[model samples]
Target: MPKLKVLNLFRIQLSLLPSSLGHLINLQTLCLDYSKIEDFAIIGKLKRLKVLSLQHSDIKELTTEISQLTQLRLLDLSNCGRLEVIAPNVISKLSQLEDLYVQLCPIQWNVEVLEELKGLSKLTRLELDIKDSKMLPQGFFSKELRRYNISIGDWPARINGDESLRTLQFKVNSTISLEEFQGIKNVEFLLFANVENGLDELQSNITPLFNEKV
Candidate 1:
């Protein structure tokens, strides 16, 4: 298996990737979605790896070695509910990262983390889970966002639209109106959570937001 370039361990029930996996210098894609991987210390040793998927994993931390994957283009960590901390400056080192998905994780972000995001010059698509909605005006949401899962206390005044935007989710706390979303009309998937009103009432409010656009 020295020449194996792709490894698919999706739901394989493995808790950790073999340190030997680092030996796969030619490996380009590694899929460990829904696996039990809690240790990825040697993952970055695969310097040529391009795509890594750890979706729904119980990942608690990422090693500093992850920064070695200079070719990394996509990192999927969606549904990682137990994830809490990430080694500082690890994300900022992936200068080639194009798409990063990190939804439903409870990691607390600091100023350095925010600064790292601002320096990702090649980032194009992002899926994030934020604790504050006010960060919108601070230049957090990008015009390049295509699919977003956001949980915030307030609705953004405006969502910059991109023809590529397809899935839009809002986990808000207050009443949201269609007028705030008039700029976006091409959304194919829409959702609302944690609103002040009941689900049915919330649906009624957003119906016009989507129906009129359709």
Candidate 2:
């Protein structure tokens, strides 16, 4: 079992990982999706781990220990409603990470957390949700990202778009200037929800196929 490369403990009704799991030095993929296990400290021992999925799990926080998996390429924390904290510099430590999914999670996003994402030089795909559109900093996302689904408000955003295109959706509650955001310049699909009168003010060279004004 020391040479195990994949472990699918998905939906397992366990509280903790077995101590022997640390012996799987060669493990590359571990899926705990929809599981009740919360303690992930043992996962840090898997130096070769490349993929980790905690979707719909009961984990409350992403502790510093998990950042030891420097080889991680894909991490899925989507639908982790209980997830609250992600230790500082933990995300930047995943130097090899290429894809990250945090959609539908209840974690509070701040400027510090958003800034940390910029350090992932290898990231190409991302799915994220920010509760307030005003919190977005100028030049938010990296220009190198090929595909993304980002929702910046409480409204339900349109998800239909070309898979090759980057999508950015946000709710406009007050008068605001969109041109200041350099990250939106490359966005192929954009949604401006609840914009009342000034649709022309937000227009740019990039025209969005979806725009809902009320």
Candidate 3:
């Protein structure tokens, strides 16, 4: 319908969206959670879209067409295990984005993608993965974020507290200068996994948390 504002296509395993879907210019919220559809070329027509959920979808690449949704506030790509490429400059175009979720996806994190995220001044919540601590750029995370659940490295991390807390879990064996990450001071929950070196150096950096590493 031309006046449709919301569409919940949850759990529907379809290969394609009806061509008529593009006519919903006024559509505001679209939920495609757990769907198998891949082609999203028509989504760009929904210029008024505020929330787009593709959680558990079978999409392999997030095309640049999605950047047309300039009004989008929330974009969920959580559990998209097969997702790979996120078109360059696509995320930066979502200037109105407040929350973004890409956790549990295999997209290789890079400095360019991280820099694009930094441009989203309005972003308040984020959930994503980094293949390793070394992938993180200096001052990578935005201090504007009020809530986040970030896992760095290969070790699996738990999503804690229903997204109410800012957490960072690192599974690395190398030294990390905590000062490089501006958001560390705001982190409420932090975990270091498999740490084998620089305990003394780490202790000197954050005295309160490193009194004695057991």
Compose the digit string of candidate 1's lDDT tens values, residues 122-212: 8867776665543333444434444544444434432333545556666654433445555454456665666666877776666776666
User: Candidate 2's C-alpha lDDT?
Assistant: 0.80
Better of 2 and 3 by lDDT: 3
What would the TM-score be for candidate 1 when compared with the true structure?
0.69
Report, for every candidate in turn, its global Cα lDDT versus the true structure.
0.71, 0.80, 0.81
lDDT of 2 at 20: 93
Clashes of each: 0, 0, 0
Q: Clashing residue pairs in candidate 1, if any?
A: none
Q: Output candidate 1 Cα RMSD.
A: 6.5
Question: Tens digit of lDDT per residue, candidate 2, span 4-112?
Answer: 8999998999989898999999999999999998888999999999999999999999989888999999999999989977887789799999999988887776767
- The residue-by-residue lDDT of candidate 3 on 7-80, one tens digit each, is 99998878888889999999999999999999987898899999999999988888999989999999999999
Error of 3 at 152 (Å): 1.3
Shift of residue 125 alpha carbon in model 3, Å: 0.9
Q: TM-score for all predictions? A: 0.69, 0.85, 0.89
Best by TM-score: 3
